[model samples]
Target: MKAKGRVLIIDDDAGIRDAAFQVLSREGYEVEMAGTAEEARRLVEEYEFDVILLDLKLPGVEGLELLQEIREEDPQAQVVVITAYGTVQVAVSAMKLGAADFLQKPFNPQELRLAVSRALEKKRLTLENIYLKRALAEKEGQVEFIGQSPAIRRVLEQAEMAAQTDSTVLLTGESGTGKGLLARLIHRMSPRAEGPFVAVDCGTLVPTLFESELFGHVRGAFTGATQHKIGKFELANGGTIFFDEIGNISLDIQAKLLKAVEEKEISPVGSHRLVRVDVRIIAATNKDLREEVRAGRFREDLYFRLHVISIQLPPLRERREDIPLLAEHFLKRYARKHCKPVEALSPEVLEAFLRYPWPGNVRELENTIERLVVFARKPVIGPEDLYFAGFEDQAPDLTLEEDLPLEEVEKRHVLRVLRACGGNKTLAAQKLGIDRKTLREKLKRWGVTP
Candidate 1:
């Protein structure tokens, strides 16, 4: 295997430095050693390393102080503390200060190698996540709103306008219509954009842990509550709190949440003092809260409080015009992510995109593009490269039914086949058992442009 990464060892003890150097070098790393923090700082200035292993009991510029200096120089740097068994507290402190890992003194060679490898892997993943986030931000302008239908355009307009407001916003949409993305856009564009935007999926939180997570808990509040904790609401005090799938939360939790929203204050589970906070709440649900309210499944008062401003996203079927744009965006993203050279989508592939009534919306489009990018052999994704075999059973109503007009049914079937194939036309015609030229004429007559 190729060399993984570089490692820097800073230790006052010559024996420990030599041992670390040998272990790390054997594990396919370019290893560097320093006898003091001053020397380590000089080496760091000269070159970047994937991991830094520092001894806490150094003679000069003791470990924690040097760790602070290293952080001040490069906040992204991964530093692992080397502590004695008795100095375990110091090691834990180092971890709180952003140290990647700790190695107790007199550790086995295998343990040292594993710790170094884990630290390097963590650093690598962190850098990769940062890069992915940057790329996602750059691509945001390409397909910010992923549909072309008038209904979708109206929804986009409402979303853009709602993003400018500080009032509580409610997003109602089908399960896969990209409600979460709209919520993120709202937070990103709002006045509190610089502040933290916390997202909590209410559907996933356990009933018992809900209050402590939302309103926080004082130390000794419950059996496992050993330390004071700041909850999601406090974390988003000056920013935005996104309550995803709010319809799934229980009535008991809703009552507590309602009080927090109305009073702008939250009392920790074990505390009498209420903490005042300013937070913008953004709630999302696939279920209609109006029906939920009448059914007594959701709080009526809380629904009105959250519905101060509302935006509804249209399904992908309503935005067929946006399919090509969304497909291209996802294609480019997945191609770059997987390091593939795949280029444009074929005409048939484009047709397939425009025909499918995407029940899963933009997410399904993205997944299909990623799948094609990974499996397609040609530089240009063709009709044959697009796959839609399973969608027939999965989407029964979307398949051409016997009651529909033959011409209209043919048009719908062709589009559905093409979309399932990622807009590939040749394969769509083959699936339809018609000539490519005939398919082209039918598409033209149907006013379907690839």
Candidate 2:
């Protein structure tokens, strides 16, 4: 196989520099040469190198001093010291000064190749470590906890316990319940936090691409699959892979997923070789898997495999006490984000927020707060400033006449929300605090085409 890195050769001897350049170049390295320390320093300023070969003896500035300069310039740069056969002790000192390895004078081609290869590999790993650390720092900030409700505290406690192990976790909740954020929290608290955390949405992935996406595929697996693709599982090896909307995956996909989860190996679509992956699976679904399995749409074995640790997130309506805290937290966050002067929510707006059922949960609450912050004419947000999706003016009144029959009130409220959403049934159902199927049944009974 061809070498896959750049190498810089800094040596005073014409023959040594020429020989090193030729060997490394023929091995597919992009090689360059500098005859003196000054020339090497100039080259270093111009381009990055994976490996540097430095001869200890130079014309003016000695190789050891030049090595110190390189280290001070870029501590992560890989360097291999070159010493004369009589200067074994100097090689040791150079190694102490951060040389990846040492090469003695008059070394054979194999020694040169091996030393360069080792140094290049070391540099690659160092870069990967730096990247992973930066990613962890950045991704850690993506999920933030704002509410102090007991429900959320319980979920976080369970997450802390789950993070201590490598077992699979299943998060069940309504849409916009922040399942994705909780998945991220579990990953950040886990021992494998140093590795990548990949989230895949099963609902968005079509059936034809589901297997290839999760298990990967070799080049030419099918039409348009021109190159080998690394699957989410392989990318998340030694870390975690969160599958969202897990209930939407087909039975065939579930079977393959079960095998990979149970056996810890997945065969690429066209390749016979099964790649081993040590990934922790954290799946989330809004639907109950037990019902899915009973209905024969989901695999029973897979359900058992994933139900090891289940966390059910309570809806925003159930956790009504947290609405004010979450509302203020969102208000402040969105105010700063949008550069708005709004400092607080009006008592009227807060009352409206508390009284209204947040069918869309935290995500919707956040969106509404952002909108209110952007459009606020005063320093405080009020009911008049409050905005709900599909509601052009203010949100609908949170109360209904209690004297009406229950059925009559339910029909009128559902119809009112439906009209507010401009006849969009899904949004209407969410506003009515019911599932789409139940909404459809109500609509059918009312003799509506929708």
Candidate 3:
């Protein structure tokens, strides 16, 4: 889809405003014009523009002062400063005030187009990065992991301990068990919390482009290497780099990564000079890295480096007592997001959640609750909304052994309930309308516990 963007032009001279309007409008932007800094400030108060062409010399108010006002109002607005031949120093000062680019008058149409395009592209990328970071933050905070269960308490203590160290950490967990969330928590609690926290999913990167993206490349490094670029290591210098699914990288890339980690420096492709960086590494994987090392799929030396502080996140099924707390958390979040008034879950729904064995772990439960909140016709979520699919074939031993057909249904339900509770068996049993002892017997018989 083509992105819709608005452009604001501010110039005292009528001729300059008209020329800018014509050029920007022709480039598919919705254009707005202002003759003075006062008019521009009024327009800015009423609306937001993707890019603003600001004249350095205004009639009364200076351009640099207006630039400061615009920045205070909307920091994300991209401003391009216009300057005359003798006023280059003013344009340089404007750049310090957050001007995205500068155009010297009288400028050609092609130069104007190029500067506008570059500024808008930069603004778009910045907005996208902000959106992704906000989404990741929401996901990380949704599951609080509160529990008194021995297994869960131990995991929390280990997490706290890991947060204090600068050594590389390796988090192993089943899919949806919140490995990414834990990585973020560790970074937030560390000494480098004020620095950047960059997370990358190694599985999503193509092998051909992986090297340039991770360590960067100099100009002319490859066919499309039009300019020198700073890679993730440079961007995340003096901070932490969370490598999600690190096992997905190829052996060639792994060796390069090991050298960078060990030497604390990176040499961009096509450049002999090395750039020194101080970055803490946190690696996570769902697969068994030791097996990969033994099979020669992963390097033994790299495996040892990443496993300095090892942590294994327990799956939802293993810590069934925490479900109700998690479910309530999800319910409140989804309600706020969807503008819903749903206040609680029905008894039957809570029972089903506690009985279900959540093969997909915490993420699946969060998704299920969000779905329930969005589609629920009533104020409370009930058992009818619970549907567990795709697990029928794999766990026949567990499902078929139960006399009740709803046993599989109940298993799905109970697991969801426990996850909602953050795996607290007493609270889960209470939510399930059963006593703690009865719940314990059922868990023992069903081979599920917290």
Q: Candidate 1's residue-wise lDDT over 1-450, tens digit each?
A: 645776789988899999888888887888889998789888775555668888888885667888877765444458888867536678678988889988888899999988988987786567445434534553544326555678877877787787787899999886668887888888888888866677787766788999998977766789998776667786675678889889988999999999999988787787664555678899999788999999999999999999999988877767787888888888888899899998988897787677665545676667668877888788988766764324333244445555766456546656776777678887765554443555675789788997
Q: Which stretches of candidate 1 lie above 4 Å from their native place? A: 1-143, 388-399, 402-450
Per residue, candidate 3 scores C-alpha lDDT tens digits across 1-450 of 232467889988899889888887788887889998889988876665778888878888877899988875556579998867436677678888999998988988889888888888887677447535644674544425555567677787888898888999999986678888888878888898877777777866778988898877767789998866657776676678889889989999999999998988777776564555678999998879999999999999999999999999997777777888788888999999999999998887776677666655777778778877887777977655544322223233333445656456556666666776789987766555443554565568689866
Question: Model 2: runs farther than 4 Å from truth?
Answer: 1-141, 387-397, 400-418, 424-449
When 1 and 3 are scored with TM-score, the better candidate is 3
TM-score of every model versus the real structure = 0.57, 0.65, 0.59
Candidate-wise lDDT, in order:
0.76, 0.79, 0.77
lDDT of 2 by residue, 312-419 (tens): 999887788888988888888878888888899888877777866565678767767777787888897666665533333334446756575555655665677787
Per-residue lDDT, model 2, residue 446, is 81
Question: Against the true structure, candidate 2 has what lDDT?
Answer: 0.79
Task: State which candidate, 2 or 3, has the greater TM-score.
Answer: 2
* Residue 133 in model 1: lDDT: 57
RMSD of each: 17.3, 12.6, 16.4
- Model 3, backbone clash pairs (residues 3+ apart or across chains), number: 36
Candidate 3: segments with Cα more than 4 A from true spot? 1-148, 387-450
